[model samples]
Target: MDVLDFDLSDREFWAKPMVERRDAFDRLRARDTPAFFAEPVVDFAPQGPGYYALVKHADILEASRNPEVFSSGSGGATNIIDMPGEFAEYFGSMINMDDPRHARLRRIVSRAFTPKMIKQFEADVNTAAAKIVDDLLDAGPGCDFVAQVAARLPLKIICDMMGIAERDYQFVYDRSNVILGGFDPEYTGGDVSQVVPRLLNAGAELQQLVQDLASYRAEHPTNDLTSSLVNANIDGERLTLQELGSFFILLVVAGNETTRNAISYGLRLLTNNPDQRALWLEDIEGRAPGAVEEIVRLGSPVNFMRRKVTRDFEMNGHLYREEEKVVMFYWAANRDRSVFEDPDRFDITRSPNPHVGFGGPGPHFCLGAHLARREITVMFRELLRRVPGIEGGKPDRLYSSFINGIKRLECTF
Candidate 1:
């Protein structure tokens, strides 16, 4: 792991305007950092405390690996929900917790999302994906792919895993969008007083849904992931309600939002790079594993994963004390030239690509990584096969600093 400069303190460094802060993050997609180190260091501290943004791949990996120093408790992940009150304690998910505790919770749910479980999803995911693409084909020519396809695929996966009815999908999806929309827009839709009440409500509904499914599974077992979660064992104790709820939070945020953004944005990347799309179409192997990797490398759905410094620590030659926060800008880091040969050019086949689009490099890596890839891969495979010459339409960004991707991508088939 290494470090790179991205000081956000200087006003001149950021060309983006404050008014457009809520707009689609054009700043990131519009350009890449120049030359070896990428862009100049950005100073993110505004009107309050100061923290560094790791722009280069080396620095982001450095911050991600040394979780002890760059702890999440100090504000490792940027959030508007945790500014004060009970929101901080209540809204903290696996992503925001440090090693020991994060390890415990993650370990329990980790078994359910393993490679085997994801493989089971392949048939179902492919089926659902084919249906989505089929629907798009019937609709034809002009369609809002984000709403009709990208958003639906991930939501359906989460609901299917939890055994929730299709009717209730909107509640979880809508709340999740607001819950994760800190930088994009003020969460005016949901209650802003705290995240606990909202979380508890969602949890209660999910628990009931799972319990019903558990009863069904007991009498009539299936190959679905829910059966696995219900049967999970942690030190011989079955998962508590709190742990189960946390799993739901991760599923909705990570499984649904992240994958949706990746697919939608991945298409945007392809549309912009017709040559690359042509390569994928023309190639005998057909982009193999590289298409998804390259797309994710460029369209990083998870903008930044934050953590606070626990004890005094040093990064990229800068020193900081405990309680100080730092942001690992995965979006910026994945395009770092030091790591990728041609960072900005979206080649369909870029090997040895070790990008951190899955949140971090080490153990605390995204639990839903396999599910996300399956979701994106299935969608793209069906999309390219069914709809010919399709391209992205007027894209509407959700405008969030965390949990980013396309909210609405108009498309012409």
Candidate 2:
């Protein structure tokens, strides 16, 4: 296919083979200026000016750093089009905001992710990973690795952190799938027109779940994040029910989906690269840090994030007009030939790996990155030790431009 043939805003573009996707991005990055694409028309929102596809690492890094100029809050960072006001109750979190509002929310949420909390979650991650592997062993092989293994760890971690009941796990999981499911027929029932309602419904359900929990936690606080959020901190700051609920939706969706997809892709990477797997197996503990970073770099699971231009600005010798939008393609940036050596190869020991899997360096850089790295490290450590010979079959990929997800991958050991 010609370089000009692929349109980033086209849904069918995401459904193409991985190689084609890579080549299209390569062509984009090879261009002197970022390619512009018309926004995908959605049922819920009016079409606006198109966005520049920032496929190169340098462009993404610069755009991420200069958040003042490239605003995430103008429309929404998660979507290319401006989000309707009703969607704010579910989708508007710190990620979609700018300072001082963004700064305030970050300060409140950062209080909950202290070292003590992360250290505690570390233990929980290990225990959960062990149980998942045990259950996988008992169930034998030929099961969906995504549902049985990859999806469970982050789901349990996030739900447990929020003090969500075990009974509500599947409820939360299904809702999250819809929120990030993109245009997938399996999740949206194959109707593009219904996508907005499905997303809003999912968001409302998740918000209600957390709000109910927040009400309970307000009266009787626990050690979980919900308790910390609902109750006042040392500074006497607290998140209102709406704030808590929206934050929970963001946490669950971002925390759960990104890590889950990373793990699934990690398995696929290992299965395809036995040498890297062997290298990791030789010293699982010692190699975990590098392996985890390599996996995240190659996975680039969260895909692209949208930012609107706040003013007329020139970046990397290209002019960006005021109010124009730009989509930072993390997956494409992660594989930029200028930055990553042998860009496509998955090398576990690739030192100085500056991939933007967790997103580029900025105020919006992933808050749960530390915990995500820990979870990936612990989960893989367990898999390598116990299910070392396990392998993932062809992935049933999620049909979405925003998230590089694997809905299901059959596994064997």
Candidate 3:
């Protein structure tokens, strides 16, 4: 096989180990290159500030904890088009931003994800999960768990929240499939130069819906997040059409994709770790919550987060020029040997869990954390209760290396 061919197929062909760091990353650092990131031997310094991969727990923690030093403003390690500049202009959601500005936008969105708002979402989530599970249960014996349960459940929940119609759910699903189709085996494929425009068009459709919802809120206000966002005042300024558009897109992306990955990964983890799965099944109360955290921490869906270095600074004895990019390695950091004991083992009973499965500290802590935690917790609770004999078949992982996730997983229950 060609050198490139060997790199892609064999995860263990790296310098250290596949989980520890990629060979490309080590080579860069060995040559004293400023930054490093993972690859299957695909070596092209990513667009954004220069970075050295932060694999150790302390390093990831320090970087994530200190936004001013490890600023998200610099917009690191991304593709040509998806940088924060384009994202802010095109969509303007808070995830693509740094603090001060990020804080203001986050607060506006945070109002809707509060304790009460999440509690209200439960009835809807339970209702959605129950119905989907009922259908899958009848289908019986063997099927793609991702399609039947994990993928469909969150897709339905988000659609309901957006107030989209029954038929439109499939449309929403298809668009999201394309967006996430960047990873896994593609249902459809093309050049990113072309596909990005298509993704943007999909984003535009979402924006238009937000605009309509905003207009609706202006005329007749209600309790929906869209309505709340439409009516929100930011420093005596209402959110612009693009802002609303961005927020809704963030909602759908964050809402559907991460949850889907977590659930799918959770099932796969459990199926493989039969001992861990038994612990969950045996301990009804405590282990259930613990299992959710364990699966999510192990899964760590948002693999690498990009940050734009706002100003020049020195760290660990090296100087970085202003606007240099930094990439936080979530996958490596989650399994950081320093923080997590027996990091590779899938122990469901793990506690004092300090994994940064969610993004790191500062103003950028995920807004939907409570909602996400509850959703994952409940999803697992219901899933294990029903799919008694669930076992591994095959995991159809996503095609994108960035948004590492499973798109389809075959399971036998």
Candidate 4:
């Protein structure tokens, strides 16, 4: 097979049209081995060894399953470049850590993210989704679907769970954008050089906000997740101020952004596939489970995550050397021909869909996957029920490799 001309690490590549991007990944997936690309140069960190782009489904699944060999902590799983020590202060939650530390944090946070806990928030999720649609209906069409609808539900739910005030919702939203802004100039103020400082500032601001809230929750404990995390459980385990702050940052950034983008993409998908929309509208609740999964499969919002090779290991007929990095392109893997039939088609009932949009099956699978699914399902249910003819115009896509975000999509009924 001929090699693709695009560079996965080139910031410009992410800004390319979706068709071109899809074609590039298709070529990568068709290759015999994972394609290697040089690390993107950034002022924040020195140049490092290039990484293999694991665009195939088998490669991503195998890599995710072997966390010990493909470490999240060696440098950091979130970035292709090793995370600087300063960056870790705010950005280094369990997502960037390995066993023991990662296990401990997951164990503690898992308590709050249990199915029962998420069920407790189900009414809030439903109520919030309904309110958002009500506002969207009042505003009528031509409003930005992202800002008016997609972004609101997740942001409100995450803040409410954290006991954050409504006044600070924008504050949290802006910072989370900056934190995961990737190379987007809109969030970075058109200065690539300033990205690191902007990210650090954003992280610092969010951390401080959470720390202050945590301090209050320490004494005035409530049923909120913040209180549950800050105070001790029956096992007497609690997050340190640093851990609490970083985890909160992760929660708001990852949880808010990923679900928000998924909903935005979900709307876009439904609009593009009206037949699927018709099928879904026929039995809203009955079809929600499958429709939501299919949306996530195609949307693949979180995109790629980087993992470092911890030792010399062979997997799926390829060898990864010690300390080498591998970037698992979830977006590409979700479209791999070997996995899903008619990969690009947006069928609302695509079954056996093992898309790793929420990271692959492993200890590192998304903690809030259940909550995210709930948010997406409830938001769509409310939209389909009230605004069944709602359709999204062309999406103003986020120019970022990490997030498949719709910055502003016009909606019309």
Find the candidate with the highest lDDT and give its number: 2
Residue pairs whose backbone atoms clash in candidate 2: none
Looking at model 4, the pairs that clash are: none
Tens digit per residue, CA lDDT, model 2, 1-413? 23598788889999999999999998998898888899998877899889999999999999999999999899889999898999998889989999888988899998657666798778789999999999999888999999999999999999999999999999999999999999999988988888889999999999999999989988999988888888866466667888888899999999999999999999999999999999999999998999999999999998999999989999999999999999999999999999999989999999989999999998999999988998999999999999899999999999999999999999999
**Model 4 Cα lDDT, one tens digit per residue, 167-225:** 99999999999988888889889988898999999999999999999999899999898
RMSD over all Cα atoms, model 1: 6.1
As a whole number from 0 to 100, the lDDT of residue 364 in candidate 2 is: 95
In angstroms, the error of model 2 at 37 is 0.7
Q: What TM value does model 2 have?
A: 0.98
Model 2: residue 330 alpha-carbon error in angstroms: 0.3
Error of 2 at 7 (Å): 0.6
Q: What are the per-residue Cα lDDT tens digits for candidate 1 across 129-179?
A: 988887888887677888788888999988887777788888778777765
Stretches of model 3 off by over 4 angstroms after superposition = 1-50, 75-89, 183-188, 234-237
Name the Cα RMSD for model 2. Answer: 1.3
For residue 125, model 3's alpha carbon misses the true position, in angstroms, by 1.5
TM-score of each prediction: 0.81, 0.98, 0.85, 0.98
Error at 98, model 1, angstroms: 2.1
RMSD of each: 6.1, 1.3, 4.6, 0.9
